[model samples]
Target chain A: MALIELRGVSKIYHLGGEEIRALDNVDLDINPGEFISIIGPSGSGKSTLMHILGCLDSPSKGSIKLDGMEIGSASARELARIRNQKIGFVFQFFNLLPKLNVLQNVELPMVYAGCSSRERRERAMDALRLVEMDNRAKHRPMQLSGGQQQRAAIARALVNSPKIVFADEPTGNLDSHTGETILKLFHDLSLKGSTIALVTHDPEIAAVTPRKIEIRDGKISKNVDAKLSGQHDGPKFAVGSQQN
Target chain B: MSLLNAILVGLREIWAHKFRSLLTMLGIILGVSSLIAMSAIVKGMEHGMKEAMIALGGLDKVLTREAPVPTWQSHLSDQARGRTMRDVEALQRSAPLIRMVSPEMALERVTISRGDKRTRPSEFVGVWPVVIEMNLHNLEHGRFFNDVDEANAHAVIVIGTAIRDDLFGSPEQLGREVIPIGERVQINGQTFTIVGMFEHYESDQDRKKREWAREHPDEAAQKQAVARGRPGYGGGGSRSGWAFDRKNRTVYCPMNTMWLRFRAASGTGNVPDPTLTDIDFKVEDLSQMEDALQQAKNVLLTTHNGIEDFSFSTQEGNIESVDQAIRNARMSGGIISAISLLVGGIGIMNIMLASITERVREIGIRKAIGATFLDVFTQILVEAVVIAIIGGLAGLVAANLLVRFLASLSPTGNTPIVTFEAMAMAFGFSVAIGVLAGLFPAFKAAKLNPIQALRYE
Candidate 1:
């Protein structure tokens, strides 16, 4: 079974008495150890798809399967358990609990998941080491540089050893140099047997991921391989090369 | 939640805005203080009144006096002077249901002289042994007259403590002899010997009884020197107005002896007409006293051909009425205090509700983090109760201090005694107020929905 699967997934929100379809029967599959990026414009439903795949929100009329286990139809507690145990989220804004230091912020998932203090501390330290943020563990987010804060957020997401990492515009708030550095870390995580799903609009940010899926007008419109360094052939694209 | 965690949470929240929390606690503090102060004041008054009642010789007693208010009046003709020995007999028969009832005859205007060391108008109370015990009197010396004196019509007397000091100036005059101011030299011509003396209230009544023997030292000296023989030259005479204020004073002689000497030689055989008043009677229980007095009155009224001039009285109802009034005042004061506390409790409830609204977000977070609603509710309620309990203790101290300060400045200059009942009730009521004050806040906290609460901005 695929590690991440979306079956006829769609999201329709009733906002102010108007039906807004954020996803239109989106179907997708990606295997373990795949580094994937879903890229699109602001209203192209790419962020909505990321939210659904990350378990932060559920699709209105579809099933989400993670590791051959159905999660979309599970109870609220079960959903929260899946979020804590199977999914790790990295946001462009770096939503760190401001009161906690680098080490404490990284320990949040384990704390919520009821890990023992000693294990949580050791695992958080290991995650920070993997992100090259172990030296800055005692500094709060406000005290750290932009790249260091993002790295700390990565440690928090990875501290629970989740099955998948879902990052939405992870480098959107960083300079190109820091953004390149973060993309390299994601590549390294994927190489080390972790599945990575990232969402970004920057072609440079997307180019590092091995697989790319595009969303437009609440539907999948573009599919390509960023690792292949190939072009997109579409209604709105100029093809450098085409892939069958 | 752990108790420590809950208490810490309460303390931390309260400390976050000290001014607001302290203001909220004021309502409970005021309520407790008022209850304590009110109870203390009423308790003090009750104590003072009881002491005064006892001083009037009727704290828990009932003495039968000629009532109808006119019984003790002088203008009722000399015919209504006192009672016959038959009245005493009837009183002794009908009176029960109490501890002691000793007949008393008190006289004033009696003079005493010991080798020109004179005491004029000395007050004397003639009492049977039981009557002395009825007053809870602790004697300094001597004993009371026994039944033998009554059977023999002996001329023996018991005197007040004040009179004893005035006549002898010392208690060592216990075995000495003295005389009463009267021409009953041998009391209807029966020679009497001075036996014992006793002390009652602030002086030696026992010594004064010895002084009654001293009034006729010549009769006593001759009797002691000679053996028992009927060869003594002493005479008995009729009653003399100069010897006593018969209307106001009572001289306790045995009823048999009183009738033998003072009863008129009237035509009634079984009992010398009871109308010929000389012997007086007293009853034991205050409740039974009125009936005993009424029986005597009925007997007299029937014998006196329905002359309504005579009266009977018992201090029973008057003293008890005052006691009941004090009790009623205490109850009303307590109720008023309770109402004020309730008003204050409502104020506390309102303030707690406001606090709950203010901390809505914190409550939501705590609940979302696996804290049961009971945990949140109990934490808030415990906070309110703690504030009240602290205030109650402070109020107790304050009330006691106020009682002491006010007692010192009282116009009557009597010591104020605050009873234990009033203090205990005040403390208990303050605690109850704490529990009552928390009810609304607890319910509000418990009823909060986690979803809605988390959504509260």
Candidate 2:
């Protein structure tokens, strides 16, 4: 069974007495251990679909299930709990709280999860170690470079071990070399069986994932699976050892 | 989030903007300190007023004075015989509730003289030895009149220090203590020997001032010289000091001596008016004052042939006035302080609103990490309350300093007392203000949409 299933999901908004449909009858499924990318231009409703899938918002009309639990019609509080336990998001700006150090930033998810401080500390350190950011745990986000900040943000996203992780233009703020390194890190995480969906406007970044879902004009335009098509030529970047 | 974490976050937030937080807390600090300081001043005033009340005898003392007959008994007004020794004897013999009765025969406008010095005593009363206890007098030197003095009408007198100061010389001027025992003086052209002299009566503040002057004579002399050069300087003493001054200007002689030597010679038809000037008594228990007054009234009624011409006046009226003044002072002070505190709360609310606005992006980040509305709300509320708590503590310290400064500024004024109850109440008010101030801002922050907040920039 799919880890997340969305059928006929729609999000509507009203502005100046005019109805605007941001999402219209979207149907999609994401299985466990699948690396996928949702790609589209701005105003194509792909961001709205990511928001609904991430549980930051509820669908106006649809049946949406995550890990076999229906959540499309859940209350705000219930949706927050689902978001805390079952999902994680990585924003383009590396949204680590500036006042907190990297370790404290990573522990924030479990802080809301109501985990014991001891458990949160241990899990947060482990997540930092996985991203090779354990050494920078005590440093604030402002002190770190763009790549390091994004790496720390990734550690925060994985600290709770959610069922799905959504990266929204994670490398959009970094230079090309740093962006390549972050994409390689994502690929390595996928190889280790983590379900990550990269949402971006760049086709080059989306090509790193084996499966791609493209959306345009409030509807899905294409859903392609390179592994199933037996045409999985890996990302254009050279496959090399991890670099810090 | 757990409350502990929220508080930690709140504290960190305050620490991040220490200057702003301190400025925000300044209002609360001023408010709380003013509240405590205001109460302390009122408390000091109450203490001084109560002291003056006690100086005028005590709460248990009641005066029996002559009053006109009621309108219903107007036709019988001519039959009224004023308070006299007969009523005093009757109350002493029949009224068990009346502990002691002192009959006073006052010679109004009486002048005492020695050599060329002449001074008018505030009160020239002829009384029994019980007058000392009735008036709470402290006879520091010489002997009071004995039964022989009253029975034989001895020409002896007991005078307060004020009269002696005028007759001979004040100890302050003579640079030594003076005991005028056995000194010959004349009262209204009648020779009398001073038998006793009561101590100088003065308020605690006045006593302190005198002692301070005695210790620092040079400074006192300089200040006095400066005051002499400037009119109205040190001329107006404390309002309550008049009570002490009046007590010090009294002169007492034997009851028969005042009647036989003074009133007897000045009465109508050459017959001495047998009426006593004043009849004062003390009750056994203050709580049973009404019943005791009633008992004395019943006894006096029998002696006066049911004339109903005299009435009772308890010290309770004076005490009630003092209490009313204290209550009025406290109410006005409390209102002013509470207004400042509310203004302080508004200051906090204004800052909290601005703070949340500045942290919109932060709020969005926190909400995106699965923080519920309650968590955000508690975080903001805790921050405001923490500011208040800190401000309240600082205010207590400030109040202590303020009170001390005031005491030093007027060392002779009533010393302001800072009570623990005032501190606790001020602190409690500040915290309550903090909560009220934080509510709107917390609600606004917590109700923010995560997406819109992220886009707030």
Candidate 3:
């Protein structure tokens, strides 16, 4: 069974008496331990799809299920609970709270998860260790380099061990070398059986994932699985690493 | 999120902007302190008024004053006879509600003199010995006029400390206390022996001042030296001080002595009137004051031939007026403090609004991490309440200092008392204001769309 399933999901907006559809009848499924990327340019509604899949928003008309529980009709509070327990998001800007240290920032998701402080501390340390950021736990985001901050943000995303993690332009704010390192980290995390989705406008970044879903004009233009097609090579991280 | 975590986050937010938080709390501090200080001042005023009321013969004492004949009884006005010993004797016999009566015959414009020193007394009334209890006088020395003095019309007088101070010399000046017993003084060419002296009457604040002065004699001497040539410096210049001063300047003599020497010698045609100048009495039960007054009125009506030319005045009217004045003062002070507190709440609200606006991105980040609307709301609300609670505590300290400063400004004025009730109430009010102030800002932050908030630059 898929970890997340979306059928006929739509998001409509009304601006000054004009109806604008940000998402139109999107059908998709994400299985456990799958590494996928949703690629599109600006204004292509890929962000909207990611928002809906991440439980940050509910669809206007759809049947959406996450981990076998229907959530499309859930209230805001229920959605927040689902988001806290079943999903995590990494933003392009490394959205770790500036006021908190890296450790505290990583502990934030579990803090909302209502975990005991002891448990939150232990789990946050484990997540930071997973991202090789345990040594920088006490450093604030502002004091860290771009790659370190992104690592910390990824630690925060994995702190709660959610069913799925969404990275929206995860390397958009970093240099090419730092971006390559972050993408390799994501590839490593996916190989370790974490279900991860990268949302980006760059095809090079999307090539790191085995499966790619391209969105255009509020519709899915292509959904490709390299493992099933046997026509595309595996993740090009080796080629990128050779260049590095 | 748990409440503890939310409060921790709120506290961190405040700590991040310490100067701004302090400025935001300034309004609450001023409000709470002013509220407490204003109540303290009103409390002081009430204390002074109550002290003055007690000095005016207490709450149960009633006076029977002569009034003009009513219009309906104008034809029988000639038959009207004023309050006299007849009415006093009648009330004692017929009015069971009347506890004790003191019929006074005042000799107006009286001056006592010994050697070259002389001073006019506030009241020089002739009375029976029962006048001591009727007037709440404390005879500190010698003895009151006995029945033998009243029967034989003895030329004896009992004076207050003020008259003693004037006739001989005050203890402060003579460096020794004078009893003045067995001393002779002349009143209008009539020689009278001083038989007793009442204690000096003063409010609590004045008593403390006097005792403090006595304890530090050198300081008292220096103060007197400085005030020697200043007009009204040593006098009872305050509004409520006169009550105590007037009580201390009284002179009393035997009622028959007054009738024989002063009243009997001066009348419309050289015939004694025999009418009493004042008739004052106390009731057995303060709760039954109305009934007691009615009974006394009935007894006096027959004594005055049903002329209705007299009226009874109870201290209750004076007490009501004093209470009304205190209520007015408290209301005005409360309103002013409440306004200041409201302004403080508005200040909190304004700052909270600005604070949430500054943290829009922060809110978005938290919300994206699975923080519910309730969590964000509680965090903001807790921050505001924390500011108020801290400000409330600081205000209490400020109020204490403010009250002390006020007391020092007028040392003789009633000392402002800070009650625990006032502090608690002010604190509760500030907290309530904080909650009210936090509501709009918290709602605005909680209702923000996470996507748009994340997009907010």
Candidate 4:
């Protein structure tokens, strides 16, 4: 079954008395274990789509189903519960709480999920090891490099064992090398059967995900697989294998 | 998130900005302290005045006098109004709670002289000896006047210690016969002789007694000295020792003697002269003082034909009133002192509010991590209450130290004390201030939107 499904979802914003359309009639389905990417220009609505799919924002129109639950009609409390239980978020800026060390950031989702402290610690360590960041668990985000911060953010998302992890411009603020490494981390997670939705303007990131969708002027313009685009440079590199 | 976790985070945020927290709580602290201070001052006043009144005389006695409706407003009349020799007799006859009661005659500006010894201006009041004895006479020499003196319109006198100094300069004046200025003693045309001397006394023994006497010169403290039997002096000027040449001073004399000699009026064509102004009677039993006073009230009420003009002022209540007056005087002062505490409470409140503003994201994070709004609200509220309680306790300790310092300044060696109520009230006010001030900010924290909060910088 699809973990996330949207049908004719649209969002409009009122800014200074002028209507701004952020999304329009977007329909998509993301199955569990699939690695997907949505690519577009800055104002093309991909980020807004990520926000809705992650349950951070609700659809203004149309029905949204997360793992077959009608999330569009969910109350604020229900949305919070869904956010804590199902979706993990990664921002380009890493979004690691500055006051928390790496392990705490990773363990945060489990803490919110009502897991025992011991259980939270155990799951956090597993996620950290999965992202190859177990050794830097005690360090604050400021002490980690761009690539490590993104890895930590990814670890935090996975600690709750959510059905899908959403990354917004995951490498927008990182160097090319760091960006490529972070994309490989997405590839690695996908190999381990973790579903991911990567939102970015970079074709390189879109190339890393097996399935790609393009957004233009607040609407989905195309659905193109990486093989269909004939972009194979990303998989050839094993970019996340820097530890090897 | 658990309450423990929320509190931990709230405290961490507060600790992170210590100075801001202190500043915010300033207002709460001051408001609490001011309330406590006013309470304390009132307590002190009550205590001080009670002591003063108790020392004046026991609360048991009542003063009675003959006063017809004067041209002035009767409402402003002294408590002694409506009491006459007849009222004293009626009270002495019918009150079941009767302790002994005595009557006094007032003589004004009477004079006396003997040979070359002319007495200075003074008072001459005829008094019964047993009534004087009711007041535990701490005589410097001779005893208070006896009933025999009242019967004979005694040439004998009981003088204050001050009189000894003016007449003979020592206790040796006990037996000396000083000439009254009137050749005997005169007040509206009557005369008497001085036969005995006693000790001088300043009415108030409180620390401010001398100062009050100094300031109010014409009252009880600042008056001229005189001899009882001097040719021109009146019966030794009551308690104040005023000067007179049978003319300017009012004196104290036995009511019995005064009634017989000068106060009696005939209902003929001749108009009667008003001679006796008032009478202060002492009671024997201190415990029965009120009962005696009530009895006197009932008897006098009827004797005067329901004249409510007479008032019975209790010595205890008088002293209590003084205490009340003192406390009332210090009400504003106490508030001023506690103003600092209010500033401190506000300091704490300010700190908490600033902290709420700074940790918006943390609150968002906690909520996102499963913290209930209740958890967040309680966390902030507890922090504020804690600051207030601590500050309030500190103020209480300071107040005690201040009271002790004031106590050291008291003449009786009694300390100005702080009651438990004051202590509790101070702390209670502090906490109240904290809660009241913290309520709005804590509510804001509880209502924060997790998504928007997470997005906050």
Flag the better candidate by DockQ, 2 or 3: 3
Estimate candidate 2's alpha-carbon lDDT, on a 0 to 1 scale: 0.90
Candidate 3 local lDDT, B1-457, one digit each (tens): 8988888888888899999989889999999999999999999988987776766677788989989999999999988878889999998899888899989999888878898988999999999888988988999999999989999999999999989988899997898988899999999878999999998887666778788998998998888787776776236345567777888889999999999989988988777788888999988898999899999988888888889999888877788898899899989999999999999999999999999999999999989989999999999999999888888889999999999999999987888989999999999999999999999999999999999999999
Q: How many clashes does each candidate structure show, in the order listed?
A: 22, 0, 0, 106
lDDT of 1 by residue, A7-85 (tens): 9999998999999999999999988888888988899899789777866567899888999998777754565567778
Best lDDT goes to which candidate? 3
Q: lDDT tens string, model 4, B39-153?
A: 6656666665555344445555565644454445455444433445676577668876766666555555554443334444455665566445444344544344566766766
Q: Cα RMSD to native, each candidate?
A: 14.4, 4.7, 5.9, 8.3
User: Which stretch of 10 consecutive residues in model 4 chain B shows the poorest summed lDDT?
Assistant: B241-250
Residues B158-223 of candidate 2 have per-residue lDDT tens digits of 999888888889999999999999999988899999999998887676787789999999998887
Residue range A7-94, candidate 4, lDDT tens digits: 9999988899998889998888888888889999999998789878877778899999999899998876677788888888887778
Instruction: Report lDDT (Cα) of residue B334, candidate 4.
Output: 60
Order candidates by TM-score, high to low. Answer: 2, 3, 4, 1
Worst 10 residues of 4 chain A by lDDT: A231-240
Best by TM-score: 2
How far in Å is the alpha carbon of B210 misplaced in model 4?
A: 8.1
Candidate DockQ values, in order, are 0.06, 0.62, 0.66, 0.27
True contacts kept of 2: 0.55
Q: What C-alpha lDDT, on a 0 to 100 scale, does residue B29 get in candidate 1?
A: 61
